[model samples]
Target: MANLLIIDTATESCSVALKYDDQVYTRSEIAPRMHGELVLPMVEAVLAEAGIKLTQLDAIAYGQGPGAFTGIRICISVVQGLAFGADLPVIGISSLQALAQGLYQDKKQARVLAAIDARMGEVYWGQYEVDANGLMKLLDQERVCSPEFVTISDPDTSIVYSAVGTGWSTYAKVLSETLNVPTVIHDKPLYPFAEYMIPMAEYLYISGESYAAELAVPVYLRDDVAKKAKDL
Candidate 1:
């Protein structure tokens, strides 16, 4: 088992989590424009509470987005710097998957869709299906586009599932009027949480899905979006 550190400032939430074996220690705050001010302190708080040091961490995991351009960049840079300083492996988890994982408890089914409001009338969307072992696998590459045009292109739609994300909560009327799929909207679980990323981080760590500091990158779905993930 690895001692892991995870961070996310990719939305209205600022969160940090440290995981060892099966235990997790987390610190989070809901501050829209306060990512810069809150992230480092949050990380220190979580590490202190967990009795872990950055040097002792086996790896650092971060939410590489399909979320806010600025928020995504801040998280990547923080993780990159911390990992580099500690000489630890680094993993980038999908922000959308973290949001979907937050909805596991309310599961009407195993399949899930994660979306975040990408502003400019568009959303960052992705699909996933949980396996028998309870691990989630990505069903498709993530996308960013207007909510009016997003759809389930996959033909197999047997199970009823809940939709989790701020994008859906924000564009409820537009989505309802557009997509015909039956969904139980989860407004409370909309924001992506660092705690939700732990299990996936552990899996990736075990599988050696990690990289060096210079390899750290954010998955920005919008090409024309000026700001890179580091700007947050």
Candidate 2:
């Protein structure tokens, strides 16, 4: 049984969860700009509900960046502090990947184009393909670009894919024109949820992707020096 704690405040959603054995306990809210206030309490609530202590966690996992700057930092800072005090390891899962995982169902293989509304009329995007065995692999690295930027650079666009994340929803017309494929979209699944963060964190833990608390870092597409408030 792996005891894993997960959090995602990289988007408007503030969510936390604990995974023990085959059971999951989660707390989530779609309150934008409330990540700092809500994440820690949600974490505490989930931990308490599961009867697990911080030190018992095998790893602390977080949805690391490519979303709200302040929101991402809030989650990473908390995870770092908790993991450091507890002497636990950490895994940094991409917010985009977490969004992709949320689209998974038992019915069929999942092909997802996960992106976040990066504001400034641009987006942070990636492609993911999940196999029948329930393993998701990134088909593309995370990138930031305009919604007009299509992902399919090749001609073999044959997979039945789902367009997910707020980026797609917000810029649907631009994305649809860009991708040219008739996309099956779930507008609500764009944000990362705590529930999707656990299994991936567990897998990374088993695979030794875990790092010391201080080593965990969020990924921001725009360098601080390059970003202007006008972009936000």
**How many residue-pair clashes does candidate 2 contain?**
1
Off by over 4 Å in 2: 106-109, 153-157, 224-232
Model 1 CA deviation exceeding 4 Å by range? 105-109, 155-158, 226-232
Tens-place lDDT per residue, model 2, 1-232, is 5789988898898988888766899898999988888888898898888887888778889988788888888888999989888998989998888888878742243777788999888899988888664756788578888888757534245655688889888888888778877577786665888788676787788888898888877788876613653355
Alpha carbon lDDT of each predicted model? 0.81, 0.81
| lDDT of candidate 1 over 1-232, digit per residue (tens) | 7789999888888888889766889998889888998999988888788776789878999988777777888898898888878999898988888887777745534677778988888888877778765666778678888988877756344656667898888888887667666666777677888988887888889888878877988788786664542353
lDDT of 1 at 86: 90
- Name the top TM-score candidate: 1
For candidate 2, report its TM-score: 0.91
Q: In model 2, what lDDT does residue 113 have?
A: 79
Candidate 2, poorest ten consecutive residues by summed lDDT: 223-232
- Candidate 1 has which clashing residue pairs, if any? 70-232, 73-229, 73-230
